[model samples]
Target: MDINYLLIHHDELLTYLREHDYAETYVNRYKTTIKQITDNASNHNWTTYEDVYQWYVDQSYSPTYLHEVRAIIGKLEQFHLHGNFPDNKKSYSSFWKIKSAYTKLSSEYKQLYEDFETQTCKGLKSSTVASYRTKISSFLYELQCKGATSLSDVTEKDVLTCFFADGVRKRSGSLCANIIRFFKILSESGNEEATRILAYIPNLRIARKNIDYLTDGEAAKIRQVLEDSNYSLSCKDRAVGRLLLHTGLRGIDIACMQLEFIDWNNDRIRIVQQKTSQPLEIPLLPVVGNAIYDYCINERPMSASPYLFLDSRAPHNNLTTDGIGYSVKKIMSAANIRQEKGRRKGTHIFRHHLAIKLLSNGVPQPVITRTMGHTAPESLSSYLHADMKHLRECALSVEDFPMAKEVFQSCLK
Candidate 1:
């Protein structure tokens, strides 16, 4: 499509859309107006819906363009009155209206998101509140673009179709996930019917196995590689590898660790997990302790963030839980430890490795559950699979011959 469609003189287009008598109701047409304006430009050869969609995500566009976008929003207000706020209220389209419904989130929906913001991650830094709010705004704009004037007008399936099959806008699974969660929260919070409507969404990236950890041998190899190449691997990476393998803590738990939490005298680590809000006191295993000590002494950035992990790039910045996986990946690549193709070398692998190591060592299931800070024992399946290598190693470690011969020799003696 024509890239110029994105080059729409939003200022000129908005001045034109403002003239329509039904401008308030037509605020939904901003996307179209923007497209049409681009179409009318000099040497307008061609364009695709994708180009227009990309324009929405582009922040480099002038603020004047944003103001023009705001002017187009006026039509959605007008369109909503005619379509949704009627005397009868039965004309539901059931079409996929992401931006429209998200833009005007009901109090129930907002409350669910707010709960996620406050109860899930305090100070709003860790919460998805920022992205969710952005999603809401994007949803409204999308609804306006789609001419989605009423929530009742769209069906759940219609939303799915628009999200997946719509050639106009190619939404990633992550975006769809956010949209789905918004509706799910709305559904859970007294709008019981909203749940039914959202049931149709394929529920993107719902990690079936919550704790995916690495195998003991695999973890051991990673550690040795890091230790050998002391110059290439950071102290934090080495410590992370060791702790992840030994303690099986999640990235969130690791990021939350501080010097005060380490009770060297008692040899325990006290952490308040975000998911369960449960205070977990895990004993400091020797391997984990060694790694921590080495990292702290050799690599910890001298900064105010007190976080166990720090970004070397931004020496003063705290290590975000978001970057934990990437950090693991970088170190893994540096170590030339691609034991498997297309498989990510991530922090979670350590947690799974611990589970496998425990189960294979004849450690009790209850103990394993508690050791890894798992809320339920049932969460061990993914770890079970990921630990296949550990199991094989355990099987191979046993010397199983001549037991009967030894018993016979003892009897003869």
Candidate 2:
């Protein structure tokens, strides 16, 4: 467990990383960081994780730099334990972390929350379950802060205070509605206090908003970046961008895409939709097909993962949802699109753009619904707001209500 012992194998580690295809620049960085740690250890004595943690804290460096240092130390630990670097993976316990408030709750309240978790998660998808767990934790944390130690101690006033604690306009109506449903479930289970709390929570009405999509000019610029070979985008980045632009696949779905999903002979791409758990199949256009082929054959990292895309780093794994979104953001920056302050630049914009384009082209609603893998046809209605061509056709003539053109002649003059 001695940190100094690990430092002795540093040369071997660098050689191993190099053999595994780590970038030369990154290898040089690792060399410098390890040298600093080694030199500091020689001046003083440090051998354990605690010593390394204190050393990290004493250094006057930004949080980002400290995090990088921590990653290096983690790599060293992996080398020492496994005799080689393993794939990037989070610890098992990281997935089960509970909020400090949950730990401090009374046994009864803790049981209540645990029961809510178990009951609510049944037959739910992983993503939906994760979301519900987070909102429930936030709700419980606020309730505990407001001094409600148990269900019996919870008052209507405490409910309102905790609900509004997230701030007025920002208060999550879905969260409150979820809490109401939780209490209604408990009431059916013969808990009178849960029944009383139900009357305090009100139904929240959510309003629909216009979807954000790329304008014609912005779309043209993105297309130029994807189409032009002279652009500085990597093969992987180009592949991801083209998939979003041409297929309208959700970022998560694209991140989870497998190599076998592409039916090259049939010219189609197929996968189960992540959000809705439904199967979707779409034609593989030449542009998207070519880009993917370029990345897979020439640029993709050597990995045993069945995923179509892998990270550029060693122990390359499937790209994550955030990673896919970041690729889109980077492409946008390169294209000089959405550079204005507070402009939306996420991958979902490409989805909206695709929907609007199809709608404008008079593509049937059922076709758009199937292409986007929407569970219901009604989901396609939102993009109609951005379908400017269709909106124009609905406009009526103002000639009937006009007083006279001559009445405005003086103002025109």
Candidate 3:
């Protein structure tokens, strides 16, 4: 635990990391970084986290190298402080930049932003809150740039102009909806200006697009790949693929699923939906259960982390939603299932497939909505397009029209 122990026992740290399955190349890079820090610093007595951080800053390394050096030093700091390597991704520094930007807004608008953020954080997921904060912050910043000192000064023209800015058109509906919600929050807080602003902004009705889903054959192929012992997928990948395919869980739900969520005795898995914040209980089929069991027993990393899944590499941490999506894409590629243009290939595709399957089997819309953790029955309406059998049932009889057969024959001729 000595201050210079990291410098003195550098080789030992590398060996320990290697033993824990850290890639050889990464360990070598760590070695090089350690040498650089020891060569440049006057004293290696890095005791506190702040002390190590300060020493790194004083080195005046380039941004890229600074990040690299800081990462290595962080590992050493973790070892000294906690007697183990770090197990989570480092929090990004951009968060502080965002907070600073928020503090710089006009006092009235800043208070509005605070209230909007507080309301969002009450039940929204962290990712959703971050997105809302970024979009709303940008809107406020633009208003400030336009010399608008108060909410009343933000006219309809300003809102329209902002909507036409780059990248806003694609997300116009969602962006406008968020703005409406923000105005609603302000109006509820007794801001008459916000009530006026709300009248000017309309939530654009977005057209409902057809849901993309895997056909029975495509799903079977992907499931086969997951179950094949010779397919060369990592344990984590197989387990994740099966979980999405069988349980119809979203990527974020799979990412946040903890070990305690699985009820072994009851053969069910319970989780709070990341997007809706509603609790969901899915029956754990044997195929899905066996895949997860195999992973936990034979393939999962040996870590004290309570998450059901973790990164396969060293400093193992729970997978993120993006990581889960990447794994699903890899599984699809291995099965030779290339997603068609304009069709989504993420984990949500499995959910769509499951919903369509249930609909085809005569499952009620409300039941489908409940199973998928949807808050409204209207959310299940999109799957109607994917249910060809049900659509066929609504077809008009050919005999209803006298000229229908003659016209069909003439067209064929």
Candidate 2, residue 388: Cα displacement in angstroms equals 2.6
Quick one: ranking by TM-score, best first? 2, 3, 1
Worst 10 residues of 1 by lDDT: 83-92
Which digits, one per residue and each the tens of the lDDT, describe model 1 over residues 63-88? 77655554343332223333222111
Candidate 3, residues 336-412, lDDT tens digits: the string is 88655655788888998999899999988888888898998888878788899989999999678678567888999
Worst 10 residues of 3 by lDDT: 91-100
lDDT of each: 0.60, 0.80, 0.79
**The candidate that achieves the highest lDDT relative to the unseen native structure:** 2
Q: Which residue pairs come into collision in candidate 3?
A: none
Decoy 3 TM-score against native: 0.78
User: Candidate 2's C-alpha lDDT?
Assistant: 0.80
Query: Candidate 2's residue-wise lDDT over 1-413, tens digit each?
Result: 36556677888888887897788887887788777777777666765654665677797788988776666666665576666563555431221245445566667777876788787777668878777656666676677778887777788888777656566743567776777777777788888898988888767665665555789899899999988988888898899999999999999999999999999999999998888888899999999999999999999987788999898887788999878978888889889988788888888888999988999998999989988899888888778887889898998877767867787787789
